[model samples]
Target: MAERIQKELKEIEKNPPDFCSAGMVGGDIRRWQATIIGPPGTPFVGGIFKLSLTFPPKYPMKPPEVTFKTKIYHPNIDRNGNICFNILKDDWSPAYTISAVLVSLCSLLSSPNPEDPLEPQIAAVFLKNKVQYEEEARKWTAKFAMS
Candidate 1:
């Protein structure tokens, strides 16, 4: 598991995506902390979103679990930090890697999916109160994710 993670890490280092910065944290080979720079033109812009990645012993076969360490106001994210992403759940595949997951998450920050929502209230906010939603998201980012 560690070897596979290291191999994936090397690939990420060579050509990282533009959204987030990732690295091993707390000196744990199995744990990583990623800092996502909220996407431009989105409510999350200029925000620092922190996420923790924990690989399963059977990772790639079983998807890694990602939870936001930083509070975020999104329909797909729950108050308890669970995310409502299909690929991260029952749709996981062996071909998926840490980089792929991170990329997906970064995309989600920009274009949120309302069809599958973890926080139902956020769904309503997304449809009816976009400006308010952005305000709450920005507030949470400042309170929790700022350096």
Candidate 2:
């Protein structure tokens, strides 16, 4: 196991995030499974979202690949579970930790960023009809994420 990976695992174990829980997947420190609880007052409240993270050997130097395992109806996430968050992309820095990533994800759920969307259709709906978007997102959360 990589030293960085071990260190991250230890940190996560010591100080877990409030809205999420994450740990090694199948005993592989490089692979992680995360469950993020939806934030209150959002359309996603009461939903439990699952995610997968795969770290590169050069972790802490490079951002891990993160994907939503549970279905979500958000502008920043696509049907294929790909997330288009800036922190996971060009804005990433080694100073970020796994806990930081999870907290950021929780924030994203609480507030969707329609400006930079992975699913343009969803973004359009979110921008044009916020009520409709919230309705659909809430429905999807109840249908898919609740399980």
* Number of the predicted model whose lDDT against the real structure is largest: 2
Candidate 1: residue 123 lDDT (0-100): 84
Worst 10 residues of 1 by lDDT: 20-29
Candidate 2 residue-wise lDDT, 15-93, digit = tens:
8889888899899888999999989988999999999999987777789999999999999999989999999989999
Residue pairs with backbone atoms closer than 3 Å in model 1 (clashes): none
Model 2 Cα shift for residue 23 (angstroms): 0.5
Give lDDT per model, in order: 0.85, 0.92
The residue pairs found clashing in candidate 2 are none
On TM-score, the candidate that comes out on top is: 2
Tens digits of per-residue lDDT for model 1, 59-146: 7678888998888989999987789998999999888877788889989888888888998898888889888888888888777766
